[model samples]
Target: MTANDTDTDVLIAGGGLAGATLALALARMVPQLRVTVAETFPLASNAEPSSYQPSYDARSTALAWGSKMIYDQLGLWPALAQHAAPIHHIHVSDRGHFGAARLHAAEYRQDALGYVVDNRWMGLCLVRELLKTQVQWLAPAEVTDMTCHGDNVRVTVTTAGETRELSARCLVVADGGRSDLRERLGFQVRHQPYGQNALIANVTTADSHQFSAYERFTDSGPMALLPHGSPTRASHQSALVWTLSDSELKEVLAMPDADKCTRLQKRFGWRLGRFTRIGECNHYPLALTLVDNPVRPGVALVGNAAHSLHPVAGQGFNLALRGLMTLVEQFRLAGEQGSNPGELAVLQRYQQLHRSDRVQTAGFSDSLIQIFGSPLAPLTAARNAGLMGLDLLPAAKRWFAGNAMGLGGRKARIQRPGFDNSKALNHD
Candidate 1:
């Protein structure tokens, strides 16, 4: 399996955002490497995948500034820009508290703190980009089992009702938070539940969002709203994510849309004025699921399969993007040294490079929850003071802003994707 005896240089399982993005990166950054993706969902085979038309109910994701830079280097940002809404400012506050923190992109000399994009649109865009790449794809396929042997990992993939075995120098598990492939591959996991669930939806307000994001901390839980644009309509809409207890979630789900909006409005305040109209509500349980050493000799896990984080801080996908690029950089190094991507040393180097980022990103989100989760009078006072302090302390604000934009600690200087013979390090 080690001696140039693999089907591809890299075989990625799961063609979701993580898998697709990783494939695109490898195809662009390391063009000499062979990459294939196995996905359970069927993809549009046409030269042009379906494009996005404005809709009120589509779910969304918040992409940090650093993520945007990475996507720009991949030449996908301009396409995404057409559908994305930039977050020029962020307002963080404690409900009913005197202290609040505001982050203005102009103050930081950045164009945007982050962006909000529709999930379906982004997925289709990724699919379109993948279609233009040399990376191979296996659709309606699943890596049912994986067995690592020698220098390569062999996967049993079921594609179009046919069972086949494929060997790859490196295997990436990007199946998501609940990955059967990861379990089958024996990746040990640590899970922690937050006793809360996130209720996500799109809502219209009385006033324009003006390219702002809001994060509100309440005794019940945390809530966030990011400006969401409608291409076909004029209603001022923002994506809503409300964390609630299990009982609260059930109650809200049973309530009428108007009542649910009332509940959200009560918690989030009159920042954007009234919640005029509410869209479909989708909910997710909050938890932290981290896999121990998500990489092995010939295999590795990326995205939610490796670490599932709380969404309040919007760090999950951004962190995954960082990790994904880090892996590609390691593979670049391996290629230069004439080493296999699946070799233990190569994958381990990737892990080491990404470990600090993973820890700090997780810590940032966890600290927010822990600091604000407690509603005791003393802690509430301290939390308010901390918020005010964060606003006043330039150094602290810069650090927080950098992390929020996915640019904190140990930088990665990305190169334009292609074969790079240049010796400029991607990280600073």
Candidate 2:
């Protein structure tokens, strides 16, 4: 076959976290398989990660223990540890509420509850690890079209001022929630808009965060304070992901630094001390988006392409990682059974492995947004009551905590109480 007709075992489109992670997982799990990743952005060091970083978003992700396990298996966590902040506790409260329920890593006998990782740092670390994998990385490339043939799928990519054709037994979409490839493949997405925006920024706390994550719910939405690496020597830093009303968002964005810090100080309370300083603030529209299905013929979707949930709980990446790990396992099983890992049967297996988790997590997140985001008096009271009830039940509390940590269900293996190893690979 000519170069244009040459085929790879698998072709992955959209090289963000999901795509990159999937490629690495497949390379490690499926031996001798040729994999190609087509990414739009030129692979660059984290020194400059897209226009998104210009604001120093100071944003961080709360990675569940499960996500950590996958990273460990991929040998990515060791490299990422330098920039990670472990959360030893989580305090959940409500605005105008008298009491708050707290979850402690000590209760679980784990080293930490979860980890707070800067997106830039983790993304760069993943890219660095990706460079070491056997998977081919195609930069500044775009997938123009894809067609499923009798035994293979043909993918056309536009890159470097030329059109190139590549065939693979299977095609994987690792794009974001709004996957262009998913649309090209005729997958339908269901969208649920919260009609709200989440404002994110890094701030300094007068009091040491002591590596705790705080989730305080208000009538508007949830305000999440995620621990970050130490602040400047003079300041104690933490990442804030706060949801706000439209007017509130506009007001906050327009506020002078001093006024904004004062407002934040009033709401966040003295637990972390006054908000002396705030980093560049950014806002993201909140939504609950999911796909009807994640697989089609030789095509499979991983990460955000499969599901994007409300970030209030911060399990988006953890869920994506779980799906990636399952896909890897399914591919390995397909190979051992003498079946093409990119074939319809293999894709179906991965779908089955993910179907429950996808539906449950998506449903859970949507319900949470609806319940907590609403201003109805009854709903607010009920939600808070439920939270209080959960606090009273040790088993239920552990289950909820496990879910947040991405360690829920039979496939999950919880590590140390405060530590997450869900992203790590279990050799045995």
Candidate 3:
């Protein structure tokens, strides 16, 4: 069908975590709205290679407390919690330094600081929840072209062997860092490479993790070890994110399995005991990318398409989730007023509402990378002192904990208590 013939209220590009979650959110929040999600990857199957499933990759994600609340609103926590490992405490320290800080969930009166879940499990949960909704899913499809009009967006998508044009009142771009649609729309982005590569692997430790996450800073870069594995399992396993310079990354990637584990134990210290077994290792370049304008007349960008941050604080997805919730609220308001969801004013309002949070979160993540990654002795001392100070000051600790938990700044509609998700968009 031609763009003019096909009817859809919203067309979302990329059915990864962000796109799929947004689709499911709209389906629950605005049942009357027709939402369509186009994904380049096919529905995951046992035969599909791990590399083909971007959303269901082997990586693990740290979901903040606020993100957990969002999932609770979507009725997904019950399922996701089954596979998640709760992080009761976060231990931050500078390797080879005396400064260290510990953040506890009890200090903030919360059950968990965050939860770590395998990306594959999270994706499967999202897809499962999505299947239960009315949102249209077009997998193994790609958007080849897009044209924005005064009132709607025309999208040309290729699925199977046929190309079809579809029209939607709003086009939501959640295609991730290398978003083709974002480029097609000509959105300018400010990209900064950190000149570092992050090596990730699932590692087993001799001692039990005790549900704690660790962020250690070394001369090379920062390293994070997040608790992982099933609750009933006896062995201690954690997802490791080790940042290293290009040369160091190459050296580590080439090391023998036993030698690699020994080197990791030496660098990471004996906090979790000796690094025993490690799963397959993967590495990716690190960069900070932010779109100049995330919203236009008929479009809005969410998730990595809008802002991709360093994983230092694990805030990228949490920030994007908040932005998506804000956008959904704006659309609900517009629908209730019989206004176009893709109107420039509506999109701009959404952008303005989220601008501060986005800026702060991105800045926070970037600052952590720069300040902790610096090798200068003076700056290193300053950071060490900062960590020590955070541990000593209650108010400062509370503020930092709240921000780290994704509860700072203006709360999203989904975060506000008493806001009914089922009745959020009952305009009809």
Candidate 4:
């Protein structure tokens, strides 16, 4: 596919976090490339934003230090940081066990290991910043189908009540894990259920979290509490993710808010004091979702559409962000070489470069479940020893911290703000 023959250089099917981030990344790195994003959700324009209103039950995501750097390069960090709570420390422990490991931001020479912000707020900030870019946004729109021609893929888009076609040299499928397009296009997926479900909610404690995040693994299941609420102010709210088996989930799901909070307090302990309140409860089955092959001809997948892992490690979105940037880097190189982004060689190169990170990340999450889900005496003792060693070994702690912070892979080639070509790709 030659650039001049297609209606656009790249057409993204879903304008969720992955697609939106990709559009902005491309707009920054390869400004000359025509990029378009069509999403089912309506894309909001930059009309002076309304007053910030707090949603106690709002869902959130933990952005790794590396992900934050990527966003900083895109000049979106300032806005995001305003509402994001910095995770100054992370405390990992084996509940009712003897081992514990702690990671601090200062020890790692970072202001934060990560930042937590509401999912909706993040989307709003991304959308606002994206509106300032040269990329095109088509929404409340859906990319219903596509057909690949000699040099481009013609996309069928349904917007409002009308249907039309748009052609692009490259098509990126980022709809989601349950993507209709991904299914319709017949991309085979490998789905392995973990026999557990994750119960998520926002909880408040009597005392502030002090910007500390907690990861507690118990015989029952693993749970994580990320510092939430205002970034600039001390807050008592934290987002919770509790893993439970079917029967346990059924029991917990049937409880009232008070009983739910009581049960949560028992599982998490009194690290942040009593669980004063619990927000809306949401649950989803845990699974290892991997596409058999994420790339075909001019098309590729990113985010959950490509790989969705158990969230115990909180690496799912971070991994997707890294992959997104990596693909953008490939597109940048392809542009420099005057090769179409949709070219099979270009797509394969991107996939090859990204596959290791995907595999390693998915493995990390899967291993966590298997290793911790067991109740054998030997396994328990070994895990406790490992956790203790992690605390005692500085180098080992650094390695683990680095991976958790999404700094384990090769850096993407997106240029930072005010940086020139020769100075670009130096983000190591």
Name the regions of candidate 1 deviating beyond 4 angstroms: 2-4, 45-50, 230-235, 412-428
List the candidates ranked by lDDT, beginning with the highest. 1, 4, 3, 2
Candidate 2 structure quality by residue, lDDT tens digits, 203-280: 887888888888887766778888888422222678888888788999999999889989887777788987888889
Q: Per-residue lDDT of 1-428 in model 1, one digit per residue for the tens?
A: 55467788899999998999999999999999999999998886552434457689988889998888889989999888888889888899999899998888877566688898888778888888888889999988999987878778888999888999998888899999999998888889999999999999899999888888999999899999988984223338999889999999999999998998898889988979998899989998999999879998889999999999889889999899989999999999899999999889998988888898898888889889999999789999998998899899987887878788877644532222352313432442
TM-score quality measure for candidate 3: 0.91
TM-score of each: 0.94, 0.90, 0.91, 0.94
Which prediction has more favorable lDDT, 2 or 3? 3
How do the residues 279-355 of candidate 4 rate in per-residue lDDT, one tens digit apiece? 89999999999995899887998999999989978899998998988899899999899888888999988889888
The regions of model 2 sitting more than 4 angstroms off are: 1-6, 45-57, 230-235, 413-428
RMSD of each: 3.9, 3.8, 4.5, 3.7
How much is the lDDT of residue 51 in candidate 3? Answer: 32
Per-candidate count of clashing residue pairs (backbone under 3 Å) = 1, 23, 0, 0
**Alpha-carbon error at 13 in model 1, in Å?**
0.4
Better of 1 and 4 by lDDT: 1
